[model samples]
Target: MTTICVDAMGGDERPEVVLEGIAAALAADPELEVLVAGDEGVVGPFAESHERARALVTTEVIGMGEHPAEAVRAKRDSSIVRGCAAVRAGEADGFFSAGSTGAIFTAATLGVGRIRGIRRPALATALPGLDGHRTIALDLGANADARPEMLVQFAHMGRAYAKVVLGVEDARVGLLSNGTEDAKGSELAVSYHEALAAAGCGFAGNAEGTDLLLGSFDVIVCDGFTGNVALKSMEGTAKYLVKQIKAAAGESKRSAVGALLFKPALKRVAAELSGDEYGGAVLLGLKAPVFIGHGATSATAVAKGTAACAAAVRGGLVDGIAQALADAS
Candidate 1:
């Protein structure tokens, strides 16, 4: 059975949405168990109603604006800290939070700890892909800068995630660059490109910004600053395009009729592009599974994130990445 510890006090909606999400997840999976960590005043009653969940009271709460590491250290009884401690102590298989991204990352790295050979943990997210496959991109704001060796490590980490969680055979890894040429981008990208090419891990050379949503590669690697910018750009662009499509469809009676006819197709496309279905970002290279959902995530998104964390734990994601690193060594 896979047991996950959740920081119930995290996120904008607090225990209400978290409890609703936990209820939904428990209803969906009979084998899953959850340890809800938060103030006993809130989480205790909710846990009592659920058969598969139990509450672990935490006295302190970490605010979003506080310094991540300092807040984690000072507020040892915070939900986020307690949840991570649960994983470290072997009381849970994974940890999930819709908390401060930096705080969650810091707690997971310092509390649950990193895998044996991981230099820095990378934040990876699944992008919509063709043929029902999701492309996994990494270093999404975990580290602002990355060395060539670190980029190589990110490739291996991403490839393992793609293979184990995404079920992609022979996952193609791409380095994000300005152009799909050998001699583009900064010295960092140039050196990283050469290193990835010689690393013999299905390197697909450089991928420009346009190739991100095209499903051109199974995994895309880049520095955190660049990757985060690209991610936000794609998100904003997707939203803009969706709005344009809706406006265009409603502009004319004929267009409205056509849209009604194609409503199902449009719904499918919207679902595919929706960030809620992606279940939040996974913090790879950690000793145990750690998922960081958006602060404004809905109950459905929280439920999906919980399920994703359980799947990663069941899939032996950490072991797969460890073995991949061992092989490369």
Candidate 2:
């Protein structure tokens, strides 16, 4: 049986929402087992109620505002740390946490460790394109300022994500830039473009910001600072456009009728744009699969994230990365 260790007290919503989500996940997958990690007072009852769950009883919690490295080192018994330790100790096949991104990264990297040759582990997620194709983007917030060589490594890892997770063989890779031309970017992008082409890791030309949703490339590579900015901008724009459309439609009876006619389609669009669709981002280059969800996650999102972690375990995501890096070397 595949088991996933969950941080039941990690997110802003805490134990209640986490427990509800876990119930949904357990009901959906009979073969799946959960090892709940949190304070005994918070996680005890839930574990008692569910036959498939076992509580780890962590005493500490890493706050959203705490420094990642410091919190991880200081709070050895934090839910985040213990969860990662569970994965490393073979108690769980994978892990899921809707916790502080920084804490999750620090704990997972230090506790579970990275693949032997990987210089840096990146956060990779599949964002849906306008054409309904999903493109894998890396360093979503892992390393704010990465070196050129790190971007090259991100390219390799991102390709593995697309191939195994998204089922895209021979996925094309691109450097995120201001223009499609190889010469039209900052020093980092320029260096990445030249190095990626030489590395022969499915190098496509440079990708403009629009290419992220336009499906112009199968994988878009960037430093965490730039990628986080671009991702937030896209998210804000989508929210703004939807709000405007709904407001305009509600202003008149005729428009309301039109909105009623397209309500289902609108919901489909919203779900597609929501980052919760695929659960959360995967911390690539680690020894095992560890998914990091949004701070404000819903029960549905938690369930989806749990399923995703299980999928990664069954899909051999870590083994796939090791083999890919070996082949590249």
Per-candidate TM-scores read: 0.93, 0.95
Clash count, candidate 1: 0
Alpha-carbon runs more than 4 Å astray in model 1: 246-268
User: Would you list the C-alpha lDDT of every candidate in the order shown?
Assistant: 0.88, 0.88
lDDT of 1 by residue, 272-294 (tens): 66656877899999999999988
TM-score of 1: 0.93
Provide backbone clash counts, one per model.
0, 0
Error of 2 at 47 (Å): 1.4
* Candidate 2 collision pairs: none
Residue-level lDDT of model 2, residues 1-329, one tens digit each, is 88999899877885788889888999999989999999999789999999899999999999888999999999999999999999999999899999999999999999899999999899888898875688999888889989887888888888888888889888899888899887988877788788888887888889888888886689999999988998889889988988999999999999999998998999888777777788788899999999988888788778889989998888888888888888988
Q: Scored by Cα lDDT, where does model 1 land?
A: 0.88
Model 1: colliding residue pairs: none
